[model samples]
Target: MSNGVSTSTDKIIVDRSRSHRNKAVSKAVRQTRERLQTGHVGNFDRELIAMHISAMLQGASIMPVFVVIIAGLGIYFTRDIQIFTWAFLTLSAHAINMLLAKRAAKQEITSESARKWRRILILGQVLIGCCWAFFAIQGCATCEGQSFAAYKGAMLLAAVCVTAMSNFMLPRAVLFSFAPTVLALCFRVALTREPLDLGLMAIFVTAVVFFTFITDRLFQSNLKILSFQSEKDDLIVELEVAKSMSDEARRRAEEANLAKSRFLASMSHELRTPLNAILGFSEVMSAEVMGPLNNPTYKEYTGDIHRSGQHLLNLINEILDLSRIEAGKYDLSEEAISLLDIAEDCIGMVQLRARAKNISISQQFEPKLPSLWADEKSLRQVVLNLLSNAVKFTPQGGEICVKVGWTAGGGQYVSIKDNGPGIPEEEIPVVLSAFGQGSIAIKSAEQGTGLGLPIVQAILAKHDGQFILKSKLREGTEAIAILPAMRVLQSLPAVEDALTVGRKRKSFA
Candidate 1:
């Protein structure tokens, strides 16, 4: 029954439509975005439209020039000319209607008074158009079937057509608005053997009345489209604001990460120096070049000393690696590398550890696998760490397969799939973060520092490669490394050679 549909999804559909419109608007919104940057806000006010209309009309040109001049010339020649009376009378009525319409648009006019004014103005314009039409016809009728009749008839016809045609400006005003003029023109043309000038005027009057009707409807339609465009422009502004906020949030996150890295570095420096000294001194005592300790208790004490030192060293190394990764200072070397060589090396290094658990370490490679462009040592370390983790977690009799292959998009991959107690779903995300280990893993492993996966992540990031882990609870976990196959040559300082520790010691000398 209504022009609009009603349902709960209707609002959602409208919102989606608005979003669609916003995308189209964004391409043209640079100037609007700049304005909003300086903190401009827009509001829908009735006076805004009224003000625009007033501004447009302030410089509007109308046909009054000819009307005034011709009427004035006639009045002057006749010596008792009251050209002002006719112009003032006709123009005043038209002006009053325009003023009423403007104030009505602003709701500044009372309903009762507006209705009364509209009737009066409509009646007045019709009367004036009709009067001119009749007046023109009369000028033709009084003319003898001679020279004066023809000339005067022609002038009257033109005048009547102009007046009747102009009233159709409002389009909808055509119905009753042209009634009087129509009657007057038909009477002069068909009812009498008039010079047919007024008859010609009637045809033009009808056409114009209809013309204004069409234009007024079209103008309103265009205004609706303009309103929709204006709203779309507003939504585009909101999207730009959202984008700016996201950028600001990302910058703040970077700043926080930097601060965290700095704090870790300071902590490492303050704590690890004394730790290294303690380990070094303990190591000297345990070696016992003075001869082996005979007491069984003394040997156990030496073993305890060695074990504690190793644990402390592991902790120190984890902390340092974490800091370096955050600071983007991890030493990495990029070279053209044989994928097969790297995979075989990692498998060999970790074979003993896996064999200790009775787990077989096997390797597979796609035939003619492409060479990788990456840091070979870093890649080896990453593979070794992940494989070691898999072996440690895997039960006895489980197999660890190391597969290397070429990917479709010029990528080389090394995947380590293990028959191990896979990571818990909730723990996988945290494991990739610093110092994150699963509850079950932390309890069972006993010696894990929870930094291995993060280190692997950091290494892969340096190579512009991907490190991904897929695991299902109680199922095997797959850790895959994908590196670009193509080599990009650039002259860079060798990563290990660039380490400045020795240089720092020399500077002290």
Candidate 2:
């Protein structure tokens, strides 16, 4: 049996314990949420900017194509050569925006750098807006009537909507992108002041306001999505760390327990040899086998030595038995055994002690019980432990009832109950644990190593059985050992029936 601490002390070993790591991750996520709820979105500005830039670039590939198509329509309707110049300038502005977006995507955008990039992208949008402004002011002079004015207003509205949808990630980028065109429309409307021109101006202003509101909403939604995803990732990492730490702790505990058991089990021989010598010498001296001791004090001392040595030997034996059971090395030499007879024998063994304590031992055995297919020695030990505990705990002149009977499942049970001070409800588990003594047991004059019940439990478990200890304060305690039904060995067929079966087999042959 080895005794050593199992905790690792190496500096390089990272303690990825779950509880601490989870707390840290939870704190970080909570802080992030607090910042967001407090209107402190600066921390996440970089992510917002990156999303805006990516969306702009994704749709950039088709913007120039859209510009060329619009320019072609304008040239056909107005018969104007200047539309070609407008298309070239608009495409140039779009190209510059795309280049800036690509450059922003390649850099590690921090919150501080995001503001600088925001301004640069807004400038690119303004340049595009100026091109649109020039187109809005051209007036389609070759086309006649209010129909031509409505066509120009519809085109400007489409341009505003497209800008709002594409640049929604960046704050104010959509508004600035079309502000120049709105100004140009106002200028054109003041010069003419026709009802149709006024209506076009009013419609264009409403479209800009509506689209800008929609853009801001989309930006908030995307920000929330990114926050939720980040939180989920952190939780997964924390849970994994916790699981690994729990597994490592469990493994270390098991290893330490096994080592302790091995150490105690290994000392059986070394311990018993000295105990045997002490018992033998003390017994001889107390009995005056070699010679009579003239001194009365020496005679009394010899007896004390013998008794103490016997107690020590018993304690060591119990420890070894429990250790062997824990180490999974306690083999059972099984046989056809009578539980009733074993219970009777154990009662007899404890009868002397019970009598010395002025306790009454009573037996209630069910007659004609079948033998059990179990280890006789183990059953005997289990019975002895229960009976001895009853005698030890029972008050003087108290009743100790021992019952052996068939179980409802056709198995068997031995119950030993004593009218003594019962164990506390909370202390029941404590007493069942190895080497654990309850409050009552600890204060009793008849103290033990507290291995008796645990050993009985282990033995019954090895026989595929259960040991139940039920107790309530001042109500006395009962220990019951129950063997499963499968271990009950029923009687075989009578000789005549066996002979008949054998004759049938021969006839078939």
Candidate 3:
């Protein structure tokens, strides 16, 4: 498929996937917000009821044993038969509560059903509380001269403590479970007006308040934990969605890149075949090799054709070079080469162009620099591209300074500086990108494919080197290509020293 069609298809796929993902995320977020909102109590109530029911079911079998044990002890202390009645009543209330929780758990617990079940459970707690109240108010007939009231108060406090710990999940149930008993204690203290009864009532009220506060705190903590867990689940879902979208984008990009590479690969041959014919035919016609073109206009037209074909061919070659480099197919033919010689050769090639423009070219080189292990053609291209750019931008009678020297890190560098209208600071990155020219370059009448600098940068990168471009508006531009120290092959010893060393090793052997 063509690049445009492939891009459109990828866009459609991405949009459809994003639309679905966005819808799902929005729905999830909306539902979570509704559940957590102050005005919408139904969802929150459902969750709370579900938790309470689970806790209630877990402690159901244990409640009866605890009731029997407490009642048996109470009977031994007070020697009253009514303790049996309290035990039976409390056990009945607990059984009713357990039945309600089981029913809620068995069915789907919606908000309405949760509210209804919570009320019924609280009522069961109140019934149990009334039984405890009766036990608190009853007197110990067989145990005279003993502190039975205090013993009753201690038992009531113990019951309150157990209720607080066990029923903290259902805060309302915890409050209602002990409210009646505390009320009965208050009434007993008011009617008797005795010091011991008043003191017991005081301690009982304080204990109830303390336990109530603790239950509320526990309830709040559970609420916070549930909220955090919900948020964490939401974040995990979002991260997964983002990751999938990223993977999809990367896959599409890779497909598009492959398509581009194939298209370029095919066009390179298709374009060059016709282009070479046009250049060859146009060269013959311009030279009047077949027959003298008597018309001056015909000769000029043939010359134009030849020049245009040559420019197009050069552009095609550059595009192919950049494509191969980007695709990592441009393997370097490493050999020991002199940076100074390469720079000098490139300067000589561009000397005619500089002379045509009346531009001055100066060279500076450090002597005795070591040879570098690199691809000679790629390095030559790098130096030539930089020189061509400098010559192109430098004005009439402008001076271009070229330098080759050692880098601070024991590497070699070739720098080409021109006294031309420099690029703007903001447009530096634009000029560096493929087919990206700065505003100034675009405005100028120069013909450029904007591939020169990018090709130079790519070639340097393949050599494990660096490219630096510094420009100031209306002042100048300097382009530097640097090769690392590892590529700088160190010089070997002389032949005589090597021969002596070889002879010494042979003698030792």
Candidate 4:
């Protein structure tokens, strides 16, 4: 009983050890197979495989013609039925292989499918090699004189040429196909036991080695060319995809902007109705048009209400105008207007506020400045917005300079400069954007809606003019609106005519 138990234990240990060893070997074999597969030509790109297959099909097409000529020669010389039979079989098999290769080239090639196709092609090549070997073995057996020697030479030459041509795509497959036939020829030549035949076989071997080297170089070159083409195709596809994404994003942004414009347009009337009522009632109460208020505080409160309502209404109007400009719906009534006149009018409009703030206003108007063809209302708004910003930002007792003159490039310009706390260079772009307030503006006592400069920019842009703002920290800010040269009206001749008419009238008087 003790012996049986020991035997059973030993058997169990042996079975477990055997199972573990088998598992290890299986794993190693799987890893090795995967490594070999990764390095195989069957793992080449699908497009490259298709290109090689197509090239092989073209070579195969020409091969049957060569075979027919060789077969005719063999029949005429040898008059042997076996040689003819083998040649016919070889031709028929090659035709079938060509058809299969054409079908494979047309099909979509994946890695596994490429491997299958390559194997089928290699098998067909080997069969053809076997037919050539049979022919050479039979033909060399019964050679008599120079005619047979010439025939054998022709066969060798044909084999070398076929191997070289077919191997351009896959050198290894061609080598496999032709090596057996060459070895068979060498063996037959060695059997002759002649010094000349041995010498010839050595030369044939050397030629085969040279042709193999050439085939390898050609295959590598073809691979590089196909890889570059594939990369170019990939880049083109990526660009097209990127362009499509960009266009989609742009289209969405436009739709959102249009929706915002519509919403602003629809709400304009609804908001202004109540705001107008508030302003009217507050004004009536502040002015005491109906009756006197018992409390002075009520009158003060009504004044505040009126002012706030007016400010709110102005902000709404500015927003609506900006929205219309962004939606490309702002219509301009073009007219010939004087830049000097517009600047003077804007300065006067802000004069009262400047005086209240104890800021001095200085003006320098260039004599005989040309008129500008522009929208009168929009141009007026641009100047007013700039002047208002200047007055609002300038400190008490600071200077505001307003200039109207010709630009250096023959255009007309209106420039407003103020000795205020100038904006920082980094903050300039921030202030130019709609509803964007800089840190300084946010901390100032005179709070604004932050839409003034943006409104000015939009209005000037509508007039085909340029609006530029230059500033330096702790120095000042200068805002210039320049009308383009195309909009500048030449007024020299008109001014001369007016002066002559005035002189004639004075003489007649």
Candidate 5:
């Protein structure tokens, strides 16, 4: 029975040994094949890989000291000289590799340099793997019972920690460093010829396979993070370039607009001089003040000439006004003035033209509306323009309503509404632009230069007031100009403290 048990035990050891050997060989083959299939590291990714390796090396530098301490303890407890020697050699080799890796990290890693350093670090990892294998083999060789279990546990724990530490670095380096040590451990345990040791060896082999899988996943994750960072940096650079181009284009546009304004300003005096002379001469000829024309055709021709000259002069004046307003050159002469008085005067001026078209004018003036601190000339012009537009657009017998009152917010407002074919809502912006007549205004017999509303808006802006135009198709159009409350003059309290003083002075006199 004893001889039979010995034979069975020996057979089990041989079978386990063979199984473990096959596993190690197959694992190595699979790793080699996978590595070859993966091809070379990308040129762009090489530096990142080097950086990762350098970081792992720096962190792993301290790991050797722990191994030395653990191995020294194992030697003290078991009195094993080989274990101490292996520990010392591993510490020395790891320290040297750490110094070299740190030096390499400081250098700028180009593609060529990265490849060279990768190979050197991998070779160092292989040497460290050999040292660990030696410790595991020699430490467990002479150990027995509880000492054997403790030493095996400590060495396995160290191997797992080392594998985990290297997971962030190149997978090839991790495989080269950890696989050999783990395989040697499995082989050593399989030689014990005991069922318990063989089972433990199987567990170790399985752990190594699982660890390699985890390391591969970690390596792939690091590559993904690096790739995303590179893409983000590239997008940021592109956005900066686009923003710079947009700024340059905007600067050029502003310069061109400034040049155009300057040109218009410089030519204003020259253009108006000839226009004024033409109007003066045409007016004299049309009125026959110089002399009576003998030909009736000449009289009619002078009338046409006078009207054309007047129209041209008005257009030029409107252009110059708008240009000066845009150039910030229109100065206001402000005074305390009554808005009601100005509205009345403007209505009176346009009443003749309105009556000629049979358009009835109506007024709604707020009783005792406050006076405005404003530019009188500009205010008068604003009112006149609104009144003229209302009269011109209104058909025969159409009614025009002009109102001067306080705004809801306590400001003064002048509103003019005309019962005419109202401007289309979409064309309101066009009519408010310089020389941008609406389709309705262009079709009407009273076509204007289209500068009226823009001028009103500009003048109101200068006064810190607001101009609002509201109209609907086929309904009447209303234009409102509001002066802010700050511009509305308020009267002082009359004789609150001075009433008694005035009465006493009267009695004394």
Candidate 6:
């Protein structure tokens, strides 16, 4: 997690999490839209959207102008028909939206207030469409002439249609606002007796669609592109995050290596001090400088000192191998050794330790387990680590078993099992990681390095094989290792070729 403060800025980053970035961006986009709508921010896209809306309004004014023309005709005919009141009502309603558009332009009103007036205009248009339809139908039934009702009904429909087109962007409060207006206009247009002006109607509709829908969509798209460009700020924020993560990882690595170096240095000094005293005393005893002791206690004391020295030396060596493995400095050797032989040797080394506890140690080998190609030293270390751990955890009179077998069809596998208080199920995986010792082993064992199983895993993995650890509380532990098998003399020709090349290069030199 990154802290919000940069140590230089007084205003902290609101939220640094990536998951919250989308919401943050949406909020920012909304605020920007409102600000632009309210004449606060005049950024390019906002200006462009405003320009597009203005252009649409200008384009739509042509419809109202047409309505005004039709209303003028209606006024002329009604004045002669002696029905001036209804005609005035009809004409006023049809021309109201046109007047509203012009007044709205002069005031520079926002869409909300403009939409309110547009709705009111739509309501009036609906009434006019009904009136024209009623009068046109009534007059046509009798001897009433075309002067009062001729194209008047159709013109009313055209006015209502234009009103619906303009009211589509209204921001709520009106439901089905356009439907009644559109239906009334449609009925009035249906009742007309005049020839259909399809071309003029289509031209009118195409103009409205172009202004309200098509051009508005284009403006929105341009703004979306502008919004995308604004993401550069986000990318810069992410780059800073990635750089910080890289720095933290590097810092952790340096700290870990430094701590390892210090541990190795301290262990080296501690181990050498004990070793020096053991060797000095042993040499003195062997040289008869301590006077030949008839008593067995002197020999026993010397043996204890030797054992202590050996124990310290083993611990030191384990520390060194683990350090080397962690540093990835150990290279695999291309030696092909009998798998059974290595297995037997590892088992033999641990037999004495198990025997001292009266623990029955066993060995089993499947038929035709082939020789494995590996670094003999590292493989031996791998096997040795497993066996030592097995023996240490085995209780008195319990059993320690080693088995060598074929794995799949091409590899050799070995399993080391012990009847000790086994590892817990949850801790089995962690046990193979560095400094990961199980609670069971930690509870029972007199000593352990914790890195032993990790070293084994690292060693086996280098040979393109791996170890499997299975355990249960109070049962037993089993460790399995599988390695790729290489037939004898497979690398002999490569070795010979290398030798020849080296000799020839030397001769040329």
* Candidate with maximal TM-score: 3
Q: Candidate 6, residues 1-509: lDDT per residue as tens digits?
A: 11121122212212111232578668866865664444322244233323434644566556446645765665555543434444565556546644654565566545555455546544544554554444333332332555444354456446545544444333211223333433443454566534443333344345444444543454455555555555555556766897899899999997998799678968898878879888778767755685886877877787777767777777787777777777777677767687778877877787778779888876666655445667888888888888888878888888876776655534667778888888778887678777777786677746676788878878876776767787888889888776654432233333567889899999999
The clash count for each model shown is 2, 3, 0, 0, 0, 0
Residue 341 shift from truth in candidate 4, angstroms: 1.0
Candidate 2: deviation at residue 334, Å? 5.3
Q: Rank the candidates by lDDT, best first.
A: 2, 3, 4, 5, 1, 6
TM-score result, candidate 6 = 0.55
Q: 295-362 in candidate 3: lDDT tens per residue? A: 99999999999989999999999999998887789999999999989988999999999999999887
Error of 4 at 269 (Å): 2.1
Report the C-alpha lDDT of model 4 over 250-367, residue by residue, as the tens digit. 9999999989988998899989999999999999998899999999999999999999999999989989998888888999999999887887788878889999999988877777
Error of 1 at 398 (Å): 1.0
Q: How high is the lDDT of residue 34 in model 3?
A: 65
Segments of candidate 2 deviating more than 4 angstroms: 1-42, 51-59, 65-87, 129-168, 179-262, 291-300, 328-342, 361-376, 401-415, 454-468, 480-509
lDDT per residue for candidate 5 within 1-509, as digits (tens), equals: 00011122112111010122578658756765565455443345575657676676657656766776777787777776666677788888788777777788778778777777777777877888787677656545555676666556556666766656564456666667766777776787767666655655666667667776777787776776665566556557866896799799989987987897777767777777887887788778878898898998988887787788788877777887887798788999999999989988898899889889998887776677777899999999999999999998889999988877766566878878888899898988788888888877889988999898999999999998888888998898999888888898899877557888888899999
**Least lDDT summed over 10 consecutive residues: which range in candidate 6?**
1-10
Q: Which prediction has more favorable lDDT, 1 or 5?
A: 5
lDDT of 1 by residue, 1-509 (tens): 01121223212211010122566457547755655454423332332334433532442234355456546654544343454555665566456545655554566534344445446546655755654444344432222454543443444445544543443233244555556655666776776655554545555566656555564665454455555557567667877897899799989998998888878778877777877787776677678766777887886787687778778777877778877877778877777777778777777788887788899876666655445667887777788788878888888889887777655445666778888888888888888777888765777845488899988878876776667788887888988776654442334675655448778778999
**Over 4 Å off, model 5:** 1-47, 53-61, 64-82, 99-108, 111-177, 188-255, 403-410, 423-428, 495-509
Off by over 4 Å in 3: 1-43, 61-84, 138-158, 286-297, 336-338, 363-373, 403-413, 482-509
lDDT of 2 at 251: 97
TM-score of each: 0.59, 0.72, 0.78, 0.71, 0.71, 0.55
How far does residue 430 in candidate 1 sit from its true spot (Å)? 4.6
Candidate-wise lDDT, in order: 0.63, 0.83, 0.83, 0.77, 0.75, 0.61
Pairs of colliding residues, candidate 1? 171-212, 171-213
Error of 4 at 204 (Å): 6.6
Model 4, which residues run further than 4 Å from truth?
1-60, 69-90, 102-111, 130-171, 181-259, 291-294, 492-509
TM-score: model 4 vs. ground truth: 0.71
